[model samples]
Target: MRVLHLAPYPPARDGIGAYARVLAAALADRGHETAVVAARPHPSSPPEVLGALGDPGLPEKIARFRPDLVHVQFAVPAFGLRVPAVLRLLRELDAPVVATLHEITRDTALLRAPGRLLYRRLASRCAALIVHTRDARAAAGSAELIPHFCAPPPPSTTTSDALRARFSLGSAPVVLAFGFIHVDKGLDVLADALRHVDDAMLVVAGAVRARDPLFKPMELRDRRHEREVRAALTRHGLAHRVVFTGHVPEAEVAAWFATAAVAVLPYRKAAQSGVAHLALASRTPLVATAVGGLPDLFSASGSATEPREAGEPSRGLLAPPGDAAELAKAIRTVLDGGGHPLQGLAPGPEEVAARTEALYERVLAGAV
Candidate 1:
């Protein structure tokens, strides 16, 4: 099968870009001819650029590529608000089309009404629609629920000792929060939560790129948000206890996970989190807010609870969204080995690729 993948390719600085890289490679490994049409070509990406998704010439490129199927990794911001134009182009393509909707933010109907209408139109045109969480299914309408896929962590010679030494971190338990810095990630909440804990250091990894063409104009980097996070830590006298390792290389991401006593996802809101999947791949214990698809990921039954037993690693802990005190307690539990570790939650890259290929076949045959 010849497949044309549409998404941001690395080093485009989008998590969906990283996902495309993995999926494209997996398809190639399975003897399918896979090509990527990235939003923009980054120097690090292995595929050819077909310009941004919103470009008028995209239909011409699709005609030239002549793929058997077109697979789009969809995020509303990645394509912007110009859905009608993009939808028209997709309809022009000769090949069957499939789209994986990355998020559908629940409960903001007033703000998202227009986009939702456009999205429904887009979904109606596709052969199949895919979503990562059950929560997103209603918005996607008739969508198949496929869990978010993650590649296994790479083996690293860099050990916890080396990582701690490099960061000059002492024996204190480290709570890690990584990924592109954004206000929605709730960095300020994490900072406040850290104040109530004792003998622990916080590491904020990743950087905020100056411009993200994948995002809408209004969603560009907010330096003011970064300043607010720093000010909060300084005001609470946690300046020395937190380390900001801005924009580390991709190779070091797993090492940061391995070095941490626990990985924290203090998101204010999310449809699902790729960072949370990365933590699971690293086999690192996680503490996350019970918002969106997070609770589903951890098999969380209900509200926060004390870890059932010690030394018996399980699938991490969950706190209610936006509760600093509850988040603090969850972090403390994990650091003390009272919380479960995340393992075997998501499928490996190969399994995901195989399932996806089957879906592609089904969609092409109109059997879905």
Candidate 2:
């Protein structure tokens, strides 16, 4: 099977792009010929990345690949925030399309159409639609819940000790806020929560998502957001307690996760979180907001009232979204080993890839 994907490829610093790259690789490893078309694909992107999504010759490139199916990694921000343009592209494409709607906003501007929902029209054009969680599927109105990929930790060059020394983390317990910084990701909430905790260094593991040609997720998202986050910490007298590592290289991601006392996903809103998946892969205990798809990330939130079953290895704690006090309390619980880890409640990479491939087959045969 020749599967052509449309997404943001490597070196773009977008999570969806990384997800697409992982899925594409998994399929290719299974003997399927897979290629990606990113929006202005990074110059360093692998050969499997066919070309830029908006190139005049993209359609010709698709012809050359002769794909059996088109899998579009759909996130409005990844497509220059143009919903109609995505629909237009899907309509123009020749092969059967299975759009994996990455970010399903039930309350976004375009989602609430005058007469009909945007997803209604979106569903009409594609052979099938894939969403990462039940919440996303419900938000889409009609879509299947295909669990996102959560692989075991990648090989690491840096160890926990090296990370501690590099960041000057001396005996201070660390709370990691990983992934790209954004307003909705609730860095301010985490800062406020840190005020209630004691002796914990908040390691912010990434910078703001920059504006790329195809993935202009945050035109206004700049270093200012980082400054604002730092300022909030300063005001809370947590200036010394926060370490902002601009961008963690792939090889060092495991180290950050391993060094953390707990990985916190303080998102105010989200369709799903790849960071949560990554944290789980690294066996980091997590304290995530009980927002879209987050509750789904854990088998059970916390075992405060009841003890975990034998061999469970249960390890996540959840708090109400935007609640600083509750967030702090959950962090305390996880830090104390009240719960043990972030083993994903989702399927593994091979399983996710196989299921995706099956879906593609179903779509191509018009049996979906």
Candidate 3:
């Protein structure tokens, strides 16, 4: 099978880009011919670049590739949140299209009304639609549910001791919050939560980037939020307890997960999280707020109760969103070995890729 993926390519500094690279590699490993039409030019052979999303030559490029399946990794901001333009592009594509909708925002009446209209139009055009969470599936009306997949962590070369020594982190327990620094991620809440957790170092990974690439032109370089976070830390006497490792290499991400006592996802709102998947795959105990698809991802038994059967532990702990005291308590519990170590919860990348392949076949066969 020949699969053509449309999204940002690897080293593009976007989550969809990283995901496309992983999914393409996994599909290739499974004996499929995979190629990408990236948002920007990359060094990948056979010239993968297709210019930007709104480029006029995209249809010609797709016709040239002539793939059996065209898989689109969809996020609103990636297409500049231009609903009409995106809908037009989807209509123009004459392939067996399968779109994975990354986010369906419903936070406000203003965004929700048009967002729904746009999604319905896109869904009508595509052969099939995919979403990561049950909530998203329900909201999308006719979309299929697929869990967000993650590659397994690489083997740790350096120990926690070495990591601590390298970063000059002493004996304090480490709490990590990774990925791009955005207001929706609730970094402010995280800073407040750290105030209640005693003797723990908070590591805020990744650098700030434009929240909306199209509208927010200078938002990438804006550090006002960072300064506010720093002020909060100083006011709470946590300035010395937090470390900001801005924009570390991708290879070193696993090491950060390995060194942490607990990985925290303090998102105020989300559809699903690839970071949460990574922490679970790494077998690191997680502490996330009960939001979006997080509860579904963490709970083995799919209930608020503990994991069914004796000796089988739960994946991680969940607290109420934006509740600093509760988050503090959960963090302490995980660091104290009271939280369950995630085990055998998520499917491997190859298995996920196989499922995706099956979806493609079904779409092509008119079974969807």
Best by TM-score: 2
Model 3 bad stretches (over 4 Å):
42-60, 81-86, 106-110, 154-162, 211-213, 217-223, 300-315, 341-343
TM-score of 2: 0.89
RMSD of 3: 3.5
Q: lDDT for every model?
A: 0.77, 0.79, 0.75
lDDT tens string, model 1, 1-368? Answer: 98988776777677887888788888889999877777654556664556566666766776777799988887755555444446776777778889888866632332488668767777777899888888788767678888888665556757778889988899998999988787677888899999888789999997775454534343444566778889989998999999999986777777888888888999888888888988877667899998788887664443343333344344478887778999999999888777654544577678888989999999888898
Instruction: For candidate 3, give the lDDT of residue 68.
Output: 88
Per-residue CA lDDT of candidate 3, range 1-368, in tens?
Answer: 88888776666677777777778889999999877766555455244555445667867776777788878888766555444555666677667789888877532222577667777777788899888888888778788777778565556665677768877789888898988886667788889989888789999878786555554743543466677888999998888889998885677778888778888998888878888877866667789888888887654654444332345454478889888888889888888888654544566678779889889989989999
Candidate 3 weakest lDDT stretch, 10 residues:
302-311
Better of 2 and 3 by TM-score: 2
**Error at 87, model 2, angstroms:** 3.8
Instruction: Kindly give the number of clashing pairs for every candidate.
Output: 3, 1, 0
Alpha-carbon TM-score of each model against the true structure: 0.88, 0.89, 0.87
Model 2 alpha-carbon drift over 4 Å, by segment: 81-86, 106-121, 212-225, 300-314, 340-345
